[model samples]
Target: MGDGPVTRETTKSAADDIRVDQWAGGVRRITITRPTLRNAYRSQTAVEIAAAIEQFTADDADQVLVITGAGGAFCAGGDLTSSYESTHADAVQLGHGVVIREGMHRVMRALALCDKPVIAMISGPAVAGGLALALACDLRIGDDTARLGDTSGMVGLLPDEGGAWLFPRAMGTDHALRMLWGCELYDAQQALELGLLTQVVPAAELESAVLALATRITRTAPLTTRVVKRMVRNAMSQSLHASLIEAEYAVAAINDTADVREGIAAFLDKRTPRFVGR
Candidate 1:
């Protein structure tokens, strides 16, 4: 961020104890760093992940976020050794209490709530909560070597972390139930066939593909993109008339932005608009 000294001092910490690397051209890559543990998510890691995403939203220099894992695994799921040892099923009522499941919810909410698009680039295994994380992203591009599954049933736990909500919405109810109940792993091609992945690129081309998508997204007017995103989301819960009203308001707002002016001028001149993300 090229913010002045005051803004620099006030900026939130991008990542804490997580391997978060920010590129110069508005792309931030967040890697779960604990490869020895296969990137199992801990409570602190979840909080840090949320904080990192919040940082990305506040920083005008960054427009896209790509989340992946280190050491060839996206995530092995929740840190089972830690959670299982601590949580007692008998202590909690049937969904009446907090259930101490806030970590997963917070992580999922952070990604889903972000205004900008998120892309998950997967190359290796994603099981249980790990698969849920990838599913939470707006788009997923995987390599041939990737694997995805919900292994919670195998370990005697119901799928958590918005998996139950997101999976049914992504894949049909029957397919989601089958994967969760059967606890089977699907390879990249199978995942693609099942509509879990947007595209399957070679392992070597994964990074480039993700970057290209980010570049394409950032080339548009930033405010227009944000409004269009909201309109699409609103359509899910509201009536078409309400959605159209929102879209009209958004278009009016976008027309007032400097990027819209540049876009109009560029179109008349038969040239590409160099958007400044205004």
Candidate 2:
């Protein structure tokens, strides 16, 4: 959808190598394009992902975001082949080496902190760090072929990059521990059963399913949607009373937005409101 002439501001840059294309209507798609490595996040790719997500958050043109992979594989894990070798076993050697960089941590944090509602469209294997990235989104829609799990333990490392925190809340603590410690892989139905995926569809329907969800979400008042999302996030770390107060303030803030006035006017006129995401 970003098919127009590339201006200095709109031209793709090195820091935004992770492709982010904005659809003019109100949706943005961020695709992890390194399919040759099963879309694994390494130093540069992770940084690019964070930068792209930051760009999406700053853009008022879109109200919904869909994150997906570019090819058959969604993501495998960290780029272990590049990160380690038998000779680099010792901490001293590993610390001095640039191979095992920690750029993915910044990427994970950016995904979690972005205010836009993110939908993960998983079409293939999304294991280890990939699953962690999917879980950070507001919703996950996976194809029947998709696999979700943390494979960190299999590679002799504990789960990092928000996996340890998100899984405990998403699935129960016991389920999270079982998946982590046992290194069990979960298919689409298993993931849905465990509350990991919001919906599971055939591979051909995966992208359409996520877009449908995005469409419905965009039909709501954007300001209120963000406010409710923020309040729910605050409730995770704050007291119930505090969360209620936060929600109250958020509602007050959304009341000042143009979308709210348009919504009211449309309802009075018995017509659909065209929210500008203002």
Candidate 3:
């Protein structure tokens, strides 16, 4: 990844509903472009988002992925018109559940399991499934205008796409319960205090802040970064003993990389190391 923006083959689905931009320093930005809908995604849009994330993970040049929305709002959640009402009349009772489980849930799972670091850049509301999507990322940066919460309760729905699991893990069981039960929406500062946001900046500074963080991450050795991401995510579910065992394997693997040698040499030589992601 160079310092300049790089061109890559853009997928048709991504071009239409999602937009993928590869910036220098191994950062790939995936933007949800349905601004008129406040970035609300239908089932098909969720599939396109999953596809873009899959591409980012497989692209060797990409080390960090930043997910955001165009026209201010991050995401308003699933497109109810396309997902529920239109299909509800024609679909069996279970069909609605099936559609969500196979569609948006898969997108959330992809974000959660991505080996590379994923960051959510939230400039506006991240409601319901949209909040779940943001929670799936490894880190979240929000702007002052940002508002986040689970809005499903208002509509007599549950946070079906990993919100129940992710919210509790991120903000503890009690806080998660309150938010879900009350449909409590928090402003950017409140979200930061609740540990929902990694950092919050003025609206105008959000992009620069996200870019600075991404740049810092890309300067590290790629192999180590990926390994660390995997290890930490695994630790969330794995027992301490199992996590240690996995870390042992990861350490051995990373120790063998040329980047490790360069890191050691750089320390001894008292100079900044240039990593080629070897």
Candidate 4:
């Protein structure tokens, strides 16, 4: 799939609270629009996010997916007040657990299963389930003003929405355990040092930095890019020998693409190659 403009028929419905924007260079930006509650994920919001992610993966024109929050904050977490039940006092503990499993878990899984590259654009606080959402992305670009943490322990709760699994994988088990247990928050610089963020920029330059990186990624052949994402994700669980075999097969498939020939020819000619993602 090649990068191009999105058509009306391919566009998703606007009824979802999340804002979906497909840019010219294959970047699909999904913005959480709720800022008053710090963009917390209600059951409906989680469903919308899951749907947007699925649409992004299915759209050939969308090569990269960027998940961001509107206003100053990224997300506060799951909106405890926005449950389907009439009131929190009337809701059973089992019902609350089911909501987390069915709503937030689905959103996190969608991001994890996406074949294309996914980036989390964090400009402010990403706490609790919000932290889990950011961790699900393949890469994270955060502003210096951003804060990251898992505050579930503070409220006598567990990180049920992929946090227990994702946090340990991103930041080591020791660091993840400390954060979860102490309910500590890390500044953007600390997050970068701890490997939670791929890069940190000034708040004013966050969008530019993210766009630049996405543009660079979109310059590569689409098939190669998608294959690399899948292979690396699989490598986390696969044995080294198995990963090597997978890489060999991936290389063979990529070699058969027209973009490979163009890439080589352009290199020999000392010119910028134009890849159509063939």
Highest TM-score scorer: 3
TM-score of 4: 0.91
lDDT of 2 by residue, 161-263 (tens): 6788888888999999999999989988999999999999888877666777787787888777877777778789998899888878877778879999999
Cα distance off (Å), candidate 2, residue 273 = 1.0
What is candidate 2's CA lDDT for residue 101?
A: 40
**What ordering of candidates by lDDT runs from best to worst?**
3, 4, 1, 2
The number of clashing residue pairs in each candidate reads 0, 0, 0, 0
What's the residue-level lDDT of 168 in candidate 2?
A: 83
Residue pairs clashing, model 2 = none
State TM-scores per candidate: 0.88, 0.88, 0.93, 0.91
RMSD of each: 4.8, 3.8, 2.5, 3.5
CA-RMSD of model 4:
3.5
TM-score pick, better of 2 and 3: 3
Residue-level lDDT of model 1, residues 1-278, one tens digit each, is: 12221211222355543667764366777878778888888777777777888777777777778888878788878787765424566643444135335567777877777888788888788888888889888889998889998888876777767888888887889999999989989999999998888899888888777777876787887777777777777687898899888878887878888998999999999999988877
Residue 35 lDDT (model 1): 82
Model 1 gets an lDDT of 0.78
- What TM-score would candidate 1 get against the native? 0.88
